[model samples]
Target: MNFSEMKDQVINGVKWYFNRNWNRDDVMNMDEISDEVHSTLKMNTRIIISMLTAYSFGSSVGFIFNYLFKVEQRFVLRLLVGITIGTGNLLYQAITTKDRREIYTGCLKYCVVIVFSIITFFLLETDTTLRMIVIHSVLILFMGYLVIYSQEILYNADFGDIDYVNCTFNVFFHFPGIMIHATRLYLQGEQQEEN
Candidate 1:
């Protein structure tokens, strides 16, 4: 291929990779709505598990920081905890998945979490325990809403049930442990299909 053709192919590939429909709503029929409902339920369960895992992990880290270390600046410590969790999650995902889309989504989620963590931790002047709780809660809530909203947008985009304007916000935001669960689910589905 010539240089111009190669450049066009690269551009098209990038567009196809990012713009691919995840839920496959275009080819879905009414009979598959039941299956979609089941899948949605499973997704919700995974999301809840993700939220709880992140909350518990953050709490444990905060406890360790509080009792073990005598750091005067608790807020900075809490911020460090968030950074550690986000970075660790992103690194783990990058190591495990060869899928570029998954890695990109993971990075996007990490960035959102870290930005929110910084804002919440620095702006709020609360006690150590309360600050930790508030920050974790905020992050969990934000991620949960983003995932659900994105799912809805993707699912309904075909039928025009949702506003197209909101389609620009499509994202797959996973919390600390969520990517592991998602990967497991993907693998399990592949195995079942193969069987």
Candidate 2:
């Protein structure tokens, strides 16, 4: 085909892919809808409690660091907090689901965190401003991940899949605690500066 014709075909293909609706059913039957509701709510309470426990543990650590240690580098503490909570949540999910693949994935994700921690530990001796910049970048990415993760949960719940509700619960639970801790730190700093 000529170049113009090939370009047209590619554009058409892209449009078709994006426009396609994967859910074949125009409307879910009443029985299927009822099943979806039951499945979505089945273990929601347990998931929420587990998530809160993990988040509280993580945030408690961050709080100590911020208030007691006077760590100005809040993002570093935040990362450690996130890793702790994420690891606990992942293991809990794997245990409850009894899924080997999820277990492996969780391990892999933790390995990344471990590597990051090791690197951060070494870099702590470097220039403070540089280290803060790096930590800030990582924190931004992590926050973005949380936002996307929450959206994924909402989408799955709306679509009646509910497969990753545990993951969603953990993200939602962990983030607010961290944010509150950060806000407290800011307020404390302001008070101290005023003094």
Candidate 3:
């Protein structure tokens, strides 16, 4: 399937998993919310990362690029982007990794982001800007869907944290969303514990 389909599947999958975890009985518990601090870092991080990956197909990057291109050298802009993305991923891994595999995966993901950012800069011609932007816009929303849904699954998933591959994806795309979902999941967990 195409990128849109893949993005939708990812987003929907996360949502579907979360729906199963929403804990209808504890939807409004206050003390139950503190569990956000103890929630699993894997899926919490993954949902954020994938959203950024999907957002590459969205206009946000292009918009940033366009604005930067106007005032800076293209090469400089690209270098900054690569460093920013890589550094962010590295910091995240350093802070959250549990084992060798996590470190390896984190490095691989940063490499991919840097590579893709370069390729995208070269491949996207000026005339086709609008089309790419529209496509990315849709992907951003799709990624958002995945993020919200995935967090839901954190509370309900039998296996859990299936998408912990990319860290930067979430850093750039979800910002506070990952935290919001974490809060919700923890709150639900708290409620369940009370009962």
Candidate 4:
């Protein structure tokens, strides 16, 4: 195929992949939904409590690690640990729910994030301008993904509900830890330059 045709095929493939239809058993007609399903659909208070507790605990651990432990140098390790904890929680939920599609997506997300985090470690020692460019590139890619593929990422396939709570959970859980590490790295770099 010619170059333009090949590019079009690739773009169409990606669009189709992201928008692939799911075959969730939970999608039933209103008349087909069992009374048990309706009865069991009360508000889940435990989810709210657990999320708050997890975020609080994660933030406290981040504060302690930054201030108490004095383990300031290995920023990548902190980020890796944070991502691991958050992703582990997601995987656990996917498994407990027995949703194969979500399990697959969660695993994919974990792998991609882990690989990106490892790559970030190598960039730590690079020159300032190069580092900034890489960071900005990552930011742009993330924002673009959010803008273009938000529906796939944020919606629940089975329920057609906007189920992005875990994303907020991960952000609250991971961002602080990573930010603390980033701040320490910046300060250390400044001190070294002064010396």
Candidate 5:
């Protein structure tokens, strides 16, 4: 083929290749689109890691607090608070429309905890001290999951007009309770396996 005709054919082939591979509109702005996708993914990943770290940390901290702070709640209740955060993180990870890796397991854990938290908080009527601790734990766990970690950060970030607190509160105030809630299930699973 003549040089000009060969060049024209090459151009057409390049365009076709790109068209098949990416949304035509996005193809031209691949960098921008990629940046957006990366940002979202990064946000999601950070929240997940934060949840994991916070739950683990809170469990230990809670155990210590029970002894050191003379906190009104029982040691077990504090531990339960940590488990609640972990479960909420897992559930948010699970139920989130974007990713399903942790969804099912997370949901199961969350539901169990929610039920337990409700019983502990209301049905049991254990004590004033225990009840407050339980309530605080539950509030932090799920609310933290919603506010921090992943979902709320991405969308619906507003938490009932409290001046849109930073992401830190999202995890601290809420997910710890989630970990506490999940701790029970984790124990149950281990017990079942042991049996």
Candidate 6:
């Protein structure tokens, strides 16, 4: 293909990736729709609670480490700590929950978090500001895609059957470390500029 044709194809591919929808269109009665909405609200509430719990736990750990060490270059250490805590939490849930589906869903959600964490780690390792910004933008887009895909999967399954709380907890458990890393980078940049 010609250069222009290849460029057009790449642009179209990106557009398609961002715009693709995975919504279900099954016709249902008003009662069924109301029931679905109610169940969704309940599940969302549980998920929000799980996310808050994870965030609080992760933030506490991160704050303790920061307070104790007073070190700026503890991204790897924090990542390891987050992973340990997240894994322990997941294992605890898996042991307590009798449902195999819940266990599998939690595992899948944890895997997704790990994958994104690794990607962010590498992307943020770049020293150039412009490059980092570009990479972060792309990362945001990919994360948005992940959110859409995850919602599609969750909505398609029986909401009550999945342990969405634990799954969401697993997904958000690493967020504190990521936030810390980003803040560290920003502070370092500021210091460099000031110097």
Candidate 5 is scored at a TM of: 0.34
Looking at model 1, the pairs that clash are: none
lDDT of each: 0.47, 0.48, 0.47, 0.42, 0.47, 0.46
Clashing pairs in 2: none
Best by lDDT: 2
Considering summed lDDT, which 10 consecutive residues are worst modelled in model 5?
21-30
lDDT of 2 by residue, 3-74 (tens): 999999999976553331212121111122234433453355246436655564565464564664345644
Off by over 4 Å in 6: 1-34, 45-128, 131-135, 156-159, 169-195
Question: What digit string (tens of lDDT, one per residue) describes model 5 on residues 1-195?
Answer: 899999999999765433321122221221222344434644554555455556555655545656654554444555555465655565455334343324334545655665566567665566554645654565445543442234334332222221233444545554544344344445766787799
TM-score of each: 0.28, 0.29, 0.29, 0.27, 0.34, 0.28
Better of 2 and 6 by TM-score: 2
Top candidate (TM-score)? 5
Better of 3 and 4 by TM-score: 3
Q: Model 5: runs farther than 4 Å from truth? A: 1-48, 55-112, 117-125, 128-152, 155-195
For candidate 6, the per-residue lDDT at 8 reads 100
**Per-residue lDDT of model 3, residues 111-170, tens digit only:** 555445445744776654544444334333443344344334334333444454344454
Candidate 1 C-alpha RMSD relative to the actual structure: 16.4
